[model samples]
Target chain A: MTSQSAAVLKKKSDRKKMGMKARENVYQGILWIFLIVLALTMILPFLYVVILSFTDSTAYQAGKLILWPEKWSTEAYQLILSGDGFMNALKSTLFITVIGTPLSVIINAGLAYMLSKPIPGKGFFNKYVMFTMLFSAGMVPNFMNIKQLGLIDNYFAMILPSLCGAWTIMVMRSFFQSLPVDLEEAAKIDGCGPLKIFARIVIPLSKPMLATMTLFAFVSYWNMYFNCVMYITSTAKQTLQVYVQKVVLSSTVSDVVDLSMDLATTVPQEVMRMAAVVVVVLPILIIYPFLQKYFQSGMMVGAVKG
Target chain B: MAKKKVKYKATNKTLRQQIYEFRWIYFLGIPGLIILLLMNYMPMRNLIMAFQDYNPHLGILKSPWVGLEHFQTLFQDDKFYNMLKNTLIISGLSLLTFPAPVILALIMNEVRNAKFKKFIQTSVYLPHFLSWAIVASLTFFLLSTEQGFVNKVAEMMGNEPTAYLFSSKWIYVIIVVQSLWKSVGWGSIVYLAAIAGIDQSLYEAAKMDGANRFQCMWKITLPSIMPTVMVMLILRMGTIISVDFEQVFLMNNAMVKQQLEVFEVYIYNNSIASGSTQYSYTTAIGIFKSVINTGLVLLTNWITNRKGYEGVM
Candidate 1:
């Protein structure tokens, strides 16, 4: 009787273990499917943009939203790049990004580095900087100030107001503080002044951080639109975002349509709009690999506890 | 005793010499300070334009202050409540989505495959770096009546195409979904970091006690990241009033203009539309928005503290 009971008990425990393994497999299956679907949702939109831009009218009509292009063509790209609209916007964006990024990095790094030191009035100055992050001067007032400063219709208007954001300064300061105290002391004993220490020791040690900041600042400047719209009134000075937006949006074409009408009208407008978007953002994709590598590390650095 | 005396003398000398030695650092900081003064602090005093009939010709110095005049205008305007409603709905819907990142992070943590996890992260984060213009344009292609993929799909299916953009029904959904698409992966970064910081030994103990993987995730991992989740939720309350001006402005068209008008856009429209802005009135609206946002943040922070979570402030 005891042997029979033990056999039944053993069978019950075996079945329970099997059930647990089965449930685990089910959970794993669902989790994998969910993640893959989420990733596709992110990726497919971009792929669709690229494919639609390259796909000719015949392929697109056949609903060729496949992973690879069929009836692939460069007509849309040629049409977009051929236009004066794209070129002018490209120039304006280049000017904004190229000039704005280095200036932002240098000024922010300078202020942040100094503020990181044990200087007189450090607390007051740090708080003064932090206050700007919390309280802003409002849109109308800021516009009025820009007008008063005679920056209307000027490119500097786009660059100057955004130069020293309080968040960047704070993050940069924390990075500076995290550096070894011994490195700075050693530099001092070697008879290096503040400028020398900054230019030589600090800049070299934090090359990766600086590179990340530069790329981030570059992306932000490249993507700048609100200031561009507010400050730049002329069509000639309009940045890529505003320009691309005008072409892509509006079911009925705006007058800029004439500027972009170099291509045959037979080409689908969707292709043209998609091409315009892809062309404008192509730089981002090219640098995407580098951005992916550094951005995560840079974000982790910024996450250091205050 | 002698060493202590030497240290005291060294301090007295170092105080004056340190300031003198670091003059370049002080000098280096001047340009940033000037820019800060010019850009941030300089415009702040103009906030008083809320009270006055601000005239550009006479400027802030000469505009006569009519106390509470603009405030009265703001309260009485029909557009005010509409803008308020849009703000609440957009922000409220977004608040409903705040847990999305935490959920994503938790699920991601369960994945033992590092390569697959990285691929998922890199793909989803692609949208975050793109400008609002690009995203809006994407929306135009996918949802716009003329060239949208949705309309095309509908037409092929022998159904009438929906004008998603021209209707108010899809406005909140469009805005919030786009925001989530753009930010959900980016937002998960914080929570993923929080999860990484959780003590691994707790999971081991749970496993020893015969807990299943799912149970360990819920009972150990979720509880460990609660403080971060609470702090983030509290901080998110502060942004309820300040909807993305860029998003709303880019998305605005003639059909749904009334439905989409938020405070910042309204201020922008009032300034640039007729070419003669009621600066004081807009400034009053700005101040009102800021005050409410500040209040919301403080209230949420206080509540979080009372609940014994970490304080955001």
Candidate 2:
């Protein structure tokens, strides 16, 4: 009797285990479907752009929407890359990113370092910083101020106004606060003053936060269209993003059909627009992987411990 | 050691020791203060431009005082009502949709498989890296009248294709949907961090009490992240009047002008109009906007506080 009862109990437990395993499998299947759908949404448009860039002008004119191009050609890429307009804009974008990002990171880091220390009138400075974040004098005054400062129509115009971002400084300050004081104290005892300690000891240890700030600043400066439009009047000085804007705006045949007859045969408007986008975006996307480790880890360092 | 102590005592006897003690503290503040004064405080003096007929030639002090004339003109303008309406509608829709990321994060936290969670996360984050210009172009290609993917699919189904972008009726809806698609993944990062910080022992304890995954999520997960959600909601409410100027400006045309004419774009239009460089008038409108935004943020925080969570106020 005891052996028979034990066998029945074992069977019941095995059935429960089987049921749990089935549920787990079902959950896994649902998760896979969700992820696949998300992946398609994220990647399909980019793929579409690439596919259209290769399609010939004749195929584009015929309104063919085939994913696999009926007539694959490199006319769009050849036109955009070989053109003087694309090259100048590309150069301006790279210049802005390289010059503006480091300037911002260094200046903001100096301000952050100062604010992070336990010093006299620290509360006064902190409040002043917070005030800027909450309220600004708005765009028109900012424009006038920059113009008066003689930054308009100049590269410094683009870089200076955005250099000392309040949020970034605040983030860096909090990040510095979270670092142990012992590291800096030891350096101080070894004949290092504040500046030397910041340069020699603190900076090397703060690579992740610095990297995150650099990437953010680089992207912001690279993608700046408003500053280019507002301040930059010369066609030659326009950044890539602003150029992309102009291209996309004028690309539709309906808008520019009356401009000229010769313009119609230059290239398919859709292909040119896509090619510009690809050029504008490709560099940043390529650089993103290098900063991926910094982005995921450093973004959270000083965000919300409070 | 005795000689060193004697030297220290000689320095302490002098006024130099007292000065040195406080010197480092004051020195640390000057660089940051100089930047703040130059960048932030100096521009604040320009706020006075709102009260004057500001002219570049006359400068701030020499510009004619206009008193409330600019504010009066701003109120009388026909576009003011429409601009304010559009701003509120777009902002309200965003507030409604902003919680989607938080919901997504909660769902993600429930996933037992680590690899699948990472896949979904990495894929969702791609759109945040894309600029509004690219996003707008993508939308146009997908929703264009004749050659768009959506229209093509509709044509295949024996139905007429609807003009999605040009339709005034659908413009706001399109803006909200686009905003959601671009930001939902990145916005959820904060909520995910808050979720991850929740104690693992809570989940273990719940499991031991016969609670299943769904029950644990409902009873433990949602409550744990409520404070972060409240803070984010309060902060978003603070910027209610501000719109993503880049996205709307890039996407909009004459077709959907009525629907898509947000306050930011409205300001841009006024700035660009011939002889519309009335800096005072523009400054007045800007001042009004900042006031309204600040008031709304405070009001929302008040509401949140009444609900018993510590709001941003």
List-wise, what DockQ does each model earn?
0.52, 0.44
Put down candidate 2 lDDT per residue, B1-313, tens digits, no spaces: 5665566576665335544654654464456566666666677778898999887788898989989888898899888788888888988998899789888888777677877787677767778777887888788878888768788778877888899989888888889988998988777778887788899999999988978777888899999888888778777877788888888888789998887887667766776333447667777888888788767766776776887765222
- Residues A1-306 of candidate 2 have per-residue lDDT tens digits of 999999999999899879887987887677678767866888788888878878877666644456777788887767677666677787887788889888788878877887887544566778887777777777776777776677777877777677776788889987888888998889878877777788877789899888888887887888888878777777778888877777766746323222322343656887877777888889778877765565346464243221
Relative to the true structure, candidate 1 reaches a TM of 0.91
Residue-pair clashes per candidate, as listed? 0, 0
The residue ranges of model 2 lying beyond 4 angstroms of the native Cα positions read A252-266, A295-298, A301-306, B1-36, B273-275, B297-313
In order of appearance, the predictions have TM-scores of 0.91, 0.90
TM-score of the first chain of model 1: 0.86
Interface RMSD of 1: 2.9
Candidate 1 chain B, which ten residues in sequence have the lowest lDDT sum? Answer: B1-10
For model 2, the local distance difference test gives 0.76
